[model samples]
Target chain A: MASVNRPNKQQNHPLDDLIRKDRIPHIWCPGCGIGTIFASCLTAIKECVATGKNGFDLDKFVMVSGIGCSGRAAGYVKLDSFHTTHGRAIPFATGLKLANRDLNVIVFSGDGDLFAIGGNHFIHAARRNINITVICVNNLNYGMTGGQVAATTPYNAKTTTTPAGNAENPFSLPLLAYASGATYVARWTMLHTRDLTVSINEALSKKGFSFIEVLSPCPVNYGRRNKEKPLETLKLYQEKSIIKNGADPSELDIDMEKGIILGKFVDIDKPTHSEKYDKLYRIE
Target chain B: MTENTTESRVLTGEHFMTGDIACAEGALAAGCRFFGGYPITPATEIAEQISLRLPRVGGTFIQMEDEIAALTSVLGASWAGLKSMTATSGPGFSLMMEAIGLGLCTETPCVIVNVQRAGPSTGLPTQGAQADMMQARWGSHGDYEIIVLAPSSPQEIFYQTITAFNLSETFRLPVIIMTDEIVGHMSEKVIIPEAGKIETVNRLRPKGRKDRFKLFEPDPNGVALMPAAGDGYKIHVTGLTHDEKGYPVMTVEAQAEMMARLTGKIRNNIDRIIQTEELFLDDAEIVFISYGVSSRTCLEAMAMARSKGIRAGFLRLITIWPFPDDQIRALAKRVKALITVEINLGQIHREVKRCAEGKAPAYLVGHPGGTVIPPERVLAMAEEVL
Candidate 1:
């Protein structure tokens, strides 16, 4: 039998320079929204590098991620990156930023890593207004650990640990960020890649602590158990999400029934941790 | 940039200082520009002292939310091209185990000072104990080797802190300064040498082409050259078992290779890492092995035994880990018996016994560690062994 010869075509990914080419075929599953969110993050980094905004350069960026499926982003990114222990990406990034104020430290991790075990560090980092950007992928469950319930899991959601439906209310991450004194807070679904990229780019340029919540779908672990396919989840996000800039953070909780509020809720300039530290301690 | 001229980074000449404060000054003198720690008893003085001194030296001191964060932040700062450190007691040291493993795996250079307090859990925060000696050896879960230095006095601790930083940088792993609450709290005369007299070691930086660099590839010295975060190396550091390129490789072969590098660095360089002080061992019939504050008592007991016509020799371990097996083995063959004195209930005694290989019987003059072991008890034990 003769094999048919297909047209041979080779193309370079647009973000090839930013991605670790050898680490391709990433651990992210098919139809997983994390890949989309990661692409958006890289796109923002690419834009920032092209514009050289605030002296932004590829050499000056460092990515830190904690343990989870999304935490693998640090491994895939072609930056000076750190794949730290579970739930400690924020503190690690804080130290990195404080040690070298010239570097732009970005923490990319999952909700379970950022909000559950790492809640104290997250709140404290925000309270101090450390000059770092935190991009949290909220998949509503612990995807890496087999669809276990997470701190951000929606009320009455089905998970491996919450088979009888979740009885506890989930945290409103934007509200938490606002209460914790984050200078910049925003939320966007993976479907809103353009908006999310823009928000990430803005947060990178902003001084002080910036947090962005990315609503992503975990199909194999989360969607399969909830009777929602990846495409169905995207459709739900498209249909249910309402973009409300400067909306009250308290109303930004994830409730599909009440409509999901998205967009920049808080954006204000403030002295960052390094700035305050230098002001008080670096006196000549 | 503001020049640091208010206080000399190295406070030269004689000054009465606590071991905790001396450790802090040692850190400053050794180019430690970043300290991330939480205030814990017995160890809190180190943080307090560093907090006041670091700013004047144009360094940073951060009080993290917890000990876990404290250690992790120190690791972060180390990777960002700073000689970084943290200090804590028993409970805090327990919380820092996982991060210590991360530091080991990533081959990050930093110093961890554990001012030992009695503890199963919060045992005696204000009192000193040698209970953590064993914990310092195997506290972090894994197959790895560590360099630990036990200092007996404020002067020794100050010198050892500098040595700790140098060893950490040389080996590219976290070096622990295992001092106790007694030594940490007790004040004594410390002479800080001039800055020019003190030697500091910085991590080996990568040279040649940056793109062709493999972050974990060892040099001839069995240590990999490290590049800081913004050095344009674009390296990936992970807690996962990784390849020479610093990328995670989840295979047995990769695991073996990584483990060999991590452990081999210290094991191969054990002779250079181990330090001990010997007193009157030339023709002694009985030998005493001790470290940290307990060695002080052992020294006194040795003198008392000598006065009573018992030929007692004292061996003080300056470096605790890499266990000085060869030294113990040789000493075991030469001496009649080994008396191990420590505040803990026979931690290092077990190691001494193992290394002794039944050539010499090892007996422990141990205490549960609320207070220091009396010299009379140690002398009595030596007489009985004789």
Candidate 2:
């Protein structure tokens, strides 16, 4: 099996081997937090597998992504990956996990890719309790598409499409996921690097639909339009973020002014899609 | 678990069954273990039959959220090392177009059953139509070749469904079984052969070390072997145009290389893929060309014309796409007229006309398609020459 843990000190960075570094100096802007969030995910996977905390099989690990800035993550990862169509990653990954139980399938995508166009698939997969990990980067706007207002864009935030102000209310991702029956759900900002990484590891280790929503910085598009600089937003997250584990998901809707509620909101045991399916169809 | 004799899963002996039920039995006989589908009007019985029979045969059936997800899940199951399929009608088949293109681009092998019904947009739900014939050929938004089979009766559909699976596995493409509502819902006697008697083809599995397996590198036959998710090959499958390594190359050369193989595999093997049935064309003055439910009407019309001392012949298409143009060209030279009978306005009739290409006076007997084209209409066309 291919090992994902070995540190290559000569490469200037430990994750250089896990990354398609030739495609480096990536398309993401300098202040964009996609790189950091991606790095944290790699670290989480490496730690979970290498430390033997989980008997994860690297060979059977597959990463799937939809079209967007974040969709490019699949092409960079040096494992079995699928860069599927726009807004269809969840359904595709759901199929992959259900088709083969041994595969540790993970869907890595963006806010517009998930909550906007892919909302139906998201609700359905969670409803079925599929065993797959979903990491959504909420940059508050469609950064790659010239900063259109997204489903998670806070009310009154300015975007290219919503220059006056976003009149639409944002969806509380945790509440939506929890209500849809996700077995594990959490929220964290990109500034909480270590905590976000740990949450990714936890979601990976869980046996049902697990979702982690990461608040990321999109300086070039989102930040410039919204008047919040990248570094300033990180500092704001540090000051205003409150860790409240086991809080009611309904109460954790992100409020840019009051504060951001961050922590694991839901984690409960449930027989996953394949578990119940296999048990019912057991060929004895 | 019981040892996979690959025998008892097959249902044998003769029985009275609908086209939908025979279709399901054909898939089970072909060693298909995964089915993902939605419930649509005429095609719903296919999902119903497969749902009940698949569990008994140790197979999996998933009723996805929608038709898009239905075909999408089947593609996923195919990559996970299962012979998978999905069934839908016109509206549902339209919803699956994007994934069909994805399946074509990725060269994923699976079967799709479109029990075609009337529709420009859900025109008639419970009735029959051959309107989707052209859509089945050029439905998805790209340039590529496809393999489609249209079965005329329940017995023929049983055999055609198995052949659809075999060809899909052999060529690494989605094979379409385009049976219409008339053939789909009608009851008839279908004889299923024993497992030992039936021949099924499985996809080529890569051998030697997993590290050496380049996922899209073709064999001499122009088809590459496949590796499942856990095969240690660690292949990357993307919908983007890709190179031989199965990685997105995003270059013109990569697309040309990929498209060349994708379109070439079936084209080069056209001699084997296109199947047709010719009846009494040896000394005929005019030929009536048809397929699916329409072909049955042509058979009756040909006999009616011959009884009137008119020399009329019938050419039935079993495989429509990668069309039997060569046969039509050959017959066009000898026949005085070539007439096509179809339920659709002029879907396959257009193909027949293009292939005939003025060598003969090409004509059509067509309808908007709520029911099968009657033999009386075909006989009327045949009487013109007599």
What's the iRMSD of model 1?
Answer: 0.6
DockQ per candidate, 2 decimals: 0.82, 0.59
Per-residue lDDT value at A94 in model 2: 71
Instruction: Please identify model 1 stretches exceeding 4 Å from their true place.
Output: A1-8, B1-6
The 10-residue segment of model 1 chain A with minimum total lDDT is: A1-10
Model 1, range B173-255, lDDT digits (tens) per residue? 99999999999999999998999999999998987899999999998879999999999999999999999999999999999
The residue ranges of model 2 lying beyond 4 angstroms of the native Cα positions read: A1-9, A21-25, B1-7
How good is the docking of model 1, by CAPRI class? high
* Candidate 1 CA-lDDT value: 0.93
Task: Please tell me which predicted candidate would have the highest DockQ against the true structure.
Answer: 1
On TM-score, the leading prediction is 1
The CA lDDT at A52 in model 2 is 70
lDDT of 1 at B163: 98
Evaluate candidate 2 and give its CAPRI docking class based on DockQ: medium
lDDT of 2 by residue, B21-48 (tens): 8898899989888898899989998888
